[model samples]
Target: MPSVPPFPRASSRTHSSPVYRQRIRHTVPAAGCLAVLLFLIAFGSSTVSAQPADPAEHVSSTEPSTSSLSSPPQTIAFTGGAWYDGTGFVNDPLYIENGRFIAERPASIDTTIALDRHFVVPPFAEAHTHRIDQKGTLEGAVDAYLADGVFYVANLNNIPAFANPLRDTLDRENTVDVALAHGGFTSPGGHPQPLYERLVDRGIYSDWTKEQLAGQAFHAVTNSEELRTAYETIRADEPDLIKAYLMFAETKNASGLTPAVLAELVEMARTDGLRVSVHAQSANDMHIAAEAGAHQIAHMPPMPFQHDDGEKWYLIPDSTAQLLAEREVSVVTTTVLADGFDDGERKERVRSIQRENLSTLHDAGVHLLVGSDTWGTGQNEALYLHGLDVFDNQTLLRLWTDTGRSIFPDRAIGRLAPDHEASLLALTCNPLSDFTCVEKIDLRIKQGYVIELPPQTTSSP
Candidate 1:
């Protein structure tokens, strides 16, 4: 294996900085499988306790809570692991108090987990997905994400009626944190319209008709008047961010939102203190979205499957890449969706295009976020990116850790340091040596609370 990079030390007290060593003498245990030991350090002696209850029942908000008999320990220590500092790992003792990482120990220790010198990294995040918006399907997605160590998710498309009522079920310590872009702005006959229509045809939404799903599934607007009214309606619902659709906006007579309308929407979202994330299907769509000052491009342009066939419309030009970087816009790599191309030659061609586009965007200094547009978690997206050979193991790890910024910019997450969220994954091996080690998480922690799961039937990372 190649050598891991040196741990970059912090220059100041910022939470973004790497760990500054503070050695404390303690007896180190022999190497063994990770073990959970709860100790009430109020007095001199230690006491053992059973595993904590599900964190969902204890925490209602993002804030940490005091540990009760039903909740996990609030003041705890995770010792004997190589903690990832967003760049490299360092052997250290990580202390948590009140669901936040603290540099020093608290007055009283509530619990301790011995990692046995495993590799610890920040919890994973999914920057794009539409799976966690339904009432009946939310629990399954949450369980899958937690089992995969994906602590954060960004639901890029949803029906407010179906998704809004279920917001209270997530963003807690037990469940994965979520940000919803309810009912994206699209043309009358745009991308997601067809997708939802198909679902309705299949009986997934047995009650709703195609006419009723128009505004409920997506907001359709053509002129400035419709755009203004639609924006107001969505803003009243209070989405985490705004979602816009631009399908081949640069192409002549394209059936999507125009640049003027998208630009206006971006301005409105900014005025309301919300960011705009645009779903762009082609290179022209991406360019237009960036020019309109959209905060994020939901996907890297994929090869056209149904429309605009027989042309490399998805290939991003150098000038557009430069403009995207200049605009400070982030792009989510949903390149894994291209794997469904059944034709061997077409699949390889798409792969070549994907490799070139990823290289171009990375070279232009554009921020690339990891996201699986499928029902799966971000782990699959990271693995697919690895197959593209566009990024190495270290780069993939960093991108996965940094995904929280695109979903929740104000909160301190996607890093392991003082003042950051107390959430992480402890793997059995070094991911720097083998990227697949990320799937081998032995323990998962979120908000100073331990997340216990049933035995898995699948293979390890």
Candidate 2:
């Protein structure tokens, strides 16, 4: 069980919905990746079940025990290959059991299916998303990224009342595994003040009050006595992670937790076995949280993060950036927010800006994760949060799948390695090369069942 930041209390009016958000194979010296993928698809459809599904359903969690896999899913052999199975550069002779890899064959030649050929990167992960559940019922937004090879999502449960059940359902189904935060706690008038205030006014939430809207209630403990109590209180619930909103986003006088307070929170949380996700947008706040040893920074602000210089564009000072890199603190850029609008090309321009920044962060060796804080209305419909070229479905898929897996290493996401949970995607093409191929997602297999693809039928030999 992990404790996370609480979602901004919204009005009775619901905010965002999830329904948004690839592929391929190998060849002989000239057969091409597409050819190999087609062969594998035809072969796989022979023994496996590729059932039609909602674009957003979670995958199965069961890993075929070595016992069950004595005779595994039919293996496919492709050539001229490129793969990322934790081990780089695998040329053909790869085995795909169910959807997980089985073994590799050398110098391929046998069947129509190909494996070790085309680039086979791992599936993507969505570090910060509010996805729907398997039941089609809703506590929060649903995820529509299944067909695109996004194997897992780090859904933020800012609203436990709604999030807990959804998380439970995912676990029960062994569907898409979720690394979740219980809910973001906030001081009554904190960043979410407006959203929370609206909900109360609309009679949507009964526990509405200005005081409860602050940032402190959600994270900060005023004194040592409260500090100990806070740790125990959170400990009782047993959480996988803890998140803190250190800033006062909407206030006329925006503020953040004092350095001392933030330091205390980090220390206390670490002792209690909790990883921290700090919501710090500005460089000042980001550096502070970093110094305090926060594990991940929630979002990159509209501008580059910088020190006290106070430039118009948000920027991170060299020193702070270096420190963050050295500490290996991951920065999750939820570029979707800034790029959500289509205001006379304004959104597109913002998307461009984000691309440059994201690329820089990536080059800097900063573990950057793609997160579309697709909260609020119509957030997921922007075509691609961080997809193709700048924001296409392809880029989005890889970013979330392969890119996001590292965020939670212990979870073992992104690949179909031996003894790993069976999370895979069978798209129309190999997503590793042209992300655009994710648009070709013909099947999305979770544990073993095909999730969002058309049902597979036996094909004529």
Candidate 3:
């Protein structure tokens, strides 16, 4: 078992709800990468099962395997392509050595792939999403993301039971690299509570009891004391980044953390050197999160909420956008989520708000990241934003590539430059002229290795 962090002792509160006090039991076996491969080879199914009666019996004590380290570095050359260099595409022959772009050509080349004058761009990234977290959705989601030319993903809120096993499986040559925010912090019975319960109701997690799922799904911290207690589990979970939720902060009895509590949580996360991504559901939520020193706002306040006075228009004030821009906190564009609203009038209303908010944020110089935050990849979000006519093709490209990669700053990816990770997508048409051409991926390359997909899906590198 991993040791928990020793946080400073604080006064306690007696909470009756299990979501607030129940200690999480990490039931997933830590067998790591080898188990994933073996399981796939044996069952050919991506859905992982719950641990057996003796869960500890299967936890492997060995170190996770690093297949890339033992293999000798290979040199590959991509010729005759117009690669995007941040601003625009330049006709240049790119070289790769040991899974990274190289300025100097190697003496010996292992293979040469001709790009056939295709448009080469850094692979797309998802800054905020939960599509790749669950076992039932993992395999198909990965295939869809790669087929759409998206190579980087972030699982914003997931349980360790499902996410921990795949920690070693992703960020490899063949799979989409992921950054997991295992179990977000939310108010008791807040946004994700209903989300997870619906999954169980839909038989997506039929085997899981609500009690077993609640503790693993989210930390229900309402005050400073609750925040400190949750830190113990935060350390145990070892999240890549901290996740905070702020919804309807202006409401009288909203189901979210207070401004003071959120500030405390942000301070703690900053002290621990972890970036914080806050889920903001409304303009007030976004303002509160930015003021609390959140590094990223997971959403652009896409949906409107019923205010205390029954107003539904959720528009971000110019001052709030300026604050976010001044703080340099990137906001993810999940405006596509509003497309699924059943009410046509409500959908149009939400879309109007999204367009206004996006323009405001863009004009204020606030960085925006591309993310669908739905079952699909970031391509859909990119298309939606393009349709809004706020951002040009080049700006959207940079947001999906460069800004999106900022979610996981530790990785050297999302750029077609020397010493950057050698992952790119080749499209048959110039995406700059026709934005739709981005969906037409001709070839995919990841980590200096050729990636082969099914026919009509994508070609080999």
Best by TM-score: 1
**lDDT of each residue in 1-461, candidate 3, tens digit only:** 11212222211211111121111111122222111100011111121121112322222332122111111226666555678887887766578887789878876554455554467899988777887776555656666676777788888888778777766556666567888887788899987888888877877764876776655788888888888998778768788888888877768767767778888988998998888898887877888898999999998876533322322436888899999999998898888887777777777777777888899899999988998787778888888888888878888887888854686687788889899888888776677787877876666778775554433332111
List model 1 lDDT by residue over 256-322, tens digit each: 6889999999999999889899988788888989889899999887743632354367888999999
TM-score of 1: 0.86
Error of 3 at 421 (Å): 0.8
Deviation from native of the Cα of residue 395 in model 2, angstroms: 9.4
Q: Number of clashing residue pairs in every model?
A: 0, 67, 0
Writing each residue's lDDT as its tens digit, candidate 2 over 1-461 gives 11112222212211122111112221111223333222322223333333324222432232211111111223333333344444332432345443444554423211232222234445555677545322332322223343334545665534444445455445422234566665443333454446555755775534546455333124335455655565565555455577766663333454545556667777877887677777775665677778889888887655322212333334556666777788888887776565435464555555565665565566666676766666421123223543525434443443455554555667555765654544544334454445444444333345433232222211100
Clashes of 1: 0
TM-score for each predicted model, relative to the true structure: 0.86, 0.65, 0.81
Q: What pairs collide in candidate 1?
A: none
Model 3 residue-pair collision total: 0
How would you order the candidates by lDDT, starting with the best? 1, 3, 2
Model 2 local distance difference test score:
0.47
The residue pairs that clash in candidate 3, if any, are none
**CA shift of 359, model 2, Å:** 4.1
Query: What 10-residue stretch in candidate 2 is worst by lDDT?
Result: 63-72
Q: Where is model 1 poorest over a 10-residue stretch in terms of lDDT? A: 18-27
Badly placed stretches (over 4 Å) of model 1 are 1-70, 303-311, 455-461
